[model samples]
Target: DAGITQSPRHKVTETGTPVTLRCHQTENHRYMYWYRQDPGHGLRLIHYSYGVKDTDKGEVSDGYSVSRSKTEDFLLTLESATSSQTSVYFCAISRDEAYEQYFGPGTRLTVT
Candidate 1:
């Protein structure tokens, strides 16, 4: 697997605790993305990085944030983990705009 690794594969937390999930990639892909999978939203983007120091938010970036300091590392932080934020976080990468992506296993976060 030349992709990301999310620590704490599964987590159970109460409302209002800040949680930080990491995405470590082995591939040197330039474009990295973070997304959350939910019932109706399917997979909505949280944040993404175009290059080492260039990052941007996506459609559903609220309540979430991201950072990418190297070619193979991207981190997503939930300032305040809440019950409504319970979902699976996935990290993906695309070498080029026309290429397909590779997604990490997933991090299941449950906030009670």
Candidate 2:
């Protein structure tokens, strides 16, 4: 099983501020993903990493960027946070892209 954790479980910030969220895993999974969960949008992919230094944009990667410097850590940064970006963010890990993913507890970010 994959063990994942996110830092700063909750946060509140003003618009235009820069925010970065960290995701760490213990299982050394090869695939890591960042997603945001909202009431109506469900879970939307923000970015994903296939391996160390191998990252790619997802459907909602406009305002976000991700970097994976190591196998166990993936970081997501918001260039300029906005109210519309406020939501619950989750980190997921999977051995393969087609395999089942395990999610972290999540981080609640509120941008005012």
Candidate 3:
């Protein structure tokens, strides 16, 4: 299994501000993903990266951006934070052709 961790763990910010969350992995996986968990929406994908500098939008990609400069790091950034974006964010990693994903601890973000 891959070891994954998210930074800050918790955050509180006002609307219109910029927020960036980080996800780090011990094992280098070919695929990395960012998802947000909400009360009713469940887990919705924000973005995913297959390789360094290669990324694509997911189900709920609006207001979010991602960058993968290195294999061990995947970043999720809110271009301009909004209250609607407040949710528990999770990072997941998987090997090539493997659908099983190992998720990070999760980051709780609150937008005021």
Candidate 4:
């Protein structure tokens, strides 16, 4: 209802598996971001895109990748996920920096 949704709200897998998380949005804002919130590290940026075909890596982009071919969709892929990657992932969008960000319900990933 907040203009966005995340798929596979909960996932559990082995230490070596590929995972892909999907973020779907109704508001065609110019900015979208993926962040992981761990126990104490707080929200760490993973990747973000300013517009279609325009993207950049964030602080925690290791083993992760993202794509935004359209304004309404963004995807985050973990190439060979590992146990250390276990965290709650969140997708957020902003039309302007001054306004509040709308966040999608998180995806919890657990690797054993």
Candidate 5:
């Protein structure tokens, strides 16, 4: 739980469009992450933020970007969405790097 929330629980857009997803938390944890789940890929990290204004790219960050301006919010944006980028995006929060993470309900995005 950790009071995590993701906006736009479901979205559908055409290819080449821009999409932005918002993740919010009331836990005030120091670490927040974004991940995408697909049929074959399972769950893959897209990006993460360690602290306010401190973020890093993850394993599958090619088409995605993330930003954290405050401790409780993390934003993920797809500069140019594609059909291949369609997936269920999850937001996670953790108190520390090695601790367990609590995930949000997830946002399903589709690109046609």
Candidate 6:
């Protein structure tokens, strides 16, 4: 797990509702990322934080937001969940600008 943990490993929600997923790491890594996995889309980056309160949007950031206030915690929020947004979300951490990233067990989200 590389000291990374995602909360609410399983979630069931209705369409148009809001959902939030959390990712915590004990490694105190400077870089944290959020990604979603779907059958055909592979993995798409949602958002990332480089340092405390320093966050940026990723390729697929629409409808999602992220925040990081501490070195060990990163939070991802879906303003309004949709069935199209149903996917397994992952959290990853890196110590530096390296290609290697350690991922947390995914959060499985379902929208009906």
**Every model's TM-score:** 0.92, 0.97, 0.96, 0.94, 0.97, 0.96
In model 3, what lDDT does residue 104 have? Answer: 93
Q: lDDT scores for all predictions?
A: 0.87, 0.95, 0.94, 0.91, 0.95, 0.94
- Model 5 has a clash total of 0
Which pairs of residues collide in candidate 4? none
Candidate 4 residue 56 Cα shift, in angstroms, is 0.5
Q: How would the candidate models be sorted by lDDT, starting from the highest?
A: 2, 5, 6, 3, 4, 1
The TM-score measured for candidate 1 stands at 0.92
Clashes in candidate 6: how many? 0
Candidate 5 residues lying further than 4 Å off, grouped into runs, are: none
> Lowest-lDDT window of 10 residues in candidate 5?
1-10
lDDT tens readout by residue for model 1, 20-83: 8888888888989899999887899889888888899999888998888888888899999888
lDDT (Cα, 0-100) at 63 in candidate 1: 90
lDDT of 2 by residue, 1-112 (tens): 4589899899999999999999999998899999999998889999999999999988999999998999999999999999999999999999999999999999999999
Candidate 1 Cα RMSD (Å): 1.3
The residue-by-residue lDDT of candidate 3 on 9-57, one tens digit each, is: 9999999999999999988888999999999888999999999999999
Model 4 Cα lDDT, one tens digit per residue, 1-112:
6789999899998887889999989998888999999988989999998898888999999999999989988899998989899999999998965667889999999988
Cα RMSD to native, each candidate?
Answer: 1.3, 0.9, 1.0, 1.2, 0.7, 0.9
Off by over 4 Å in 1: none
Q: Report the Cα lDDT for candidate 2.
A: 0.95
Residue 50, model 1: lDDT of 88
User: Could you give candidate 5's per-residue lDDT for residues 29-82 as a string of tens digits?
Assistant: 999999999998788999999999999999999989888989999999999999
Q: Which prediction has more favorable lDDT, 3 or 5?
A: 5
True lDDT of residue 1, candidate 6: 52
